[model samples]
Target: MINSVSIVPDFFQRVKTISFPEVIRVFYDEEPRRSKIHCPFHEEKTPSFHIYENGFFCFSCGEKGDSIDFIVKLYNLRPINAAKLIAERFGLPVSNGPLSRQDMLRLARAKAERLREKRLKEAFDNWARLAGQQVRILAEAIRLQLEEKGLDIEEDLLPLVHELPRLEWWANILAEGTGEEKLELFRNKDFRRWFTCKN
Candidate 1:
């Protein structure tokens, strides 16, 4: 059964970030700032679980979250889990959690997601600008290297030479191929040689 008032501090104060593994540790160990609890996600002893002031990582079963997310994941649960848990523990009738409280959480989550997406977009914008400059520099350097080596440069590769794909696309592409294929696509050996020789 969960406590009526959270023994941990307010969610905001408890952690700046949260992760599953750390929460698991808080559940297990008697950390000074965090509490020891049985990791609900897995079987264990001696409380290898932990939760940060902000509810970050867990050392066991890799269950983690912010206070809310922690609770959700802890139960192998969903957004509705808290409401249900509270209802069950307190012997109250379950009615879709509390409407007002759940709505507030939904709002907070929506706002947070928007902010995260905006921040990510901004970061990508910055990376795009930097990549533009980097691509130019790389292109120029590559051109010079090719020229010095008396190698023919492909005229069609200007775009590819100038900018890396966006991070999302890059991730997708990297994940799309097999290890050997990805290594080949990335020209990993060439990069390694370049880095080693440059140093």
Candidate 2:
């Protein structure tokens, strides 16, 4: 039998290091929050499988794991699969049991490069999400202001008016804003420029 006790430390350490989202894409659909996705290992219509970022636990079956446990459970794979899967997705190579010090350093460098790319992607997505939210709030505010001023437009006018400044009110607000005021300054370009310059 595999010595679970002896491997626990290594197992957990590897899991901690592996990128969770990349693993989900291998056996599960791209989107995990869909409440269901077609299980690759079986045929079903309702898609009872759900993959979380940290792990996957099928409601239909009790298969679950961090990335390593995931590969093993799904394909009857071993730690080798765990290493290979991570390396393949991350574009690193599996480690040979016997490596010279130079080879070991190369593996470490590859792993680090993979990790940095993952982090950059995550940060970009987060920035996009936040930026999108700010744009939405600004659009809503402009719509309300235009309506209040009796400046009505058809649906087609949305694109044209979105980029126009109704007034510099948001900028003025930001100029003397408290902490909350500064946080909401994304709606105003002048304020954004001012803040950027000031900083």
Candidate 3:
């Protein structure tokens, strides 16, 4: 019903003007880089999902839809309900009925999922920051081994250069991997060990 452009509500047209990135921010930690993020409808390593002025497309999953459709899939809501939720969140002029118990549960679950994802991303960010520092420390440790080592902690870092190739790969994950890939490294026990070593 709402899909028919000519017969759509005036508020629906306004919804088109709503920034998709802003819509994403309502339930996400930040706006996605380059207008893309991991697909909300499916698991993906790369950011194959992109948002545009009127809609979104996930290259990996072949999912495509407008702003309301994005919300429907992201939160697993009915199309009408998704539109109403968008209206309420963006302060658009659309009539939204009282929430059903099921609607409440769906919203609650969506919010909790968003929170869990946010915490995970925050943890990854902290770990990535540490990894970056380790990259610098690895360089310094290699330097100390090659040219300047009178320090007592030199014993722990003597092998830094030898492990350079492997650890550099981990550092590159922080530099270039997708959100999911970056988080994947954070969950790696060995990757955590390198950063925690005395530097």
Candidate 4:
């Protein structure tokens, strides 16, 4: 069996050394060092989320925690499971218990689930980044297409097309949308075509 007393302190020490904001950024986009982003814990038009060196606090929703707490909240995992994930991610050694067939299968399933979530998060990030870039490119293309057709478009509206609302919309979709919804988004033929094209 694992020695909890000896291993817990070492596990926490290693976890504490990891930068809290850096870990937040891996799962959500945040500006470096005290910049505000939309609170992942609550829905709002304005940003009330703040990340400090030691921890994070959401002003709107009153959510506050350190790195381990953040992982528990983000992943909806129990404390022990979160600890296991952190230990695995950081390559910290955990004292092994005797494995039965069921235990081995459960461990394998958990690892696979984590891997699937990682891949989905990566794909979501990639889609969001490309969508942001495409907004600018598509706007320019539309302006050109309109010009070619001799259509009059307002000058002020041109800048608005590439502004914060577009980005925020995409962020909301990624942050709040279900997995099936995200998959459906990527399945759009136009999006797939654009995603494959060279920039």
Pick the lDDT winner: 3
Model 4: residue 158 alpha-carbon error in angstroms? 19
lDDT of 3 by residue, 35-154 (tens): 887887788888888878677889888999888888888789987778778866654545334467765766667667767867876876776777767775676567666565545445
**Candidate 1 residue lDDT tens string, 1-199:** 5564562333223232333334333343332233555555678865655645655554876766565565566556664554354333323334323447655666567557656756865664454444334444555665565566543557665444443333233344344433344334345554334222110
Q: Name the better of 3 and 4 by lDDT.
A: 3
Sequence-dependent TM-score of model 1: 0.26
**What is the lDDT, from 0 to 100, of the residue 184 in candidate 1?**
48
Q: List the residue pairs that clash in candidate 4.
A: none
Candidate 3 TM-score, C-alpha based: 0.51
Better by TM-score, candidate 3 or 2: 3
Could you give candidate 2's per-residue lDDT for residues 25-73 as a string of tens digits? 5445434436445665567777777766676666776555667776776
Number of the top candidate by TM-score? 3
- Candidate 4 worst ten-residue window by lDDT: 190-199
- Arrange candidates, best TM-score first: 3, 2, 4, 1
At residue 64, candidate 1 shows an lDDT of 65
List ranges where model 4 is wrong by over 4 Å: 29-34, 95-199
Better of 1 and 4 by TM-score: 4
Residue 153 of model 4 has an lDDT of: 53
TM-score list, all predictions:
0.26, 0.48, 0.51, 0.44
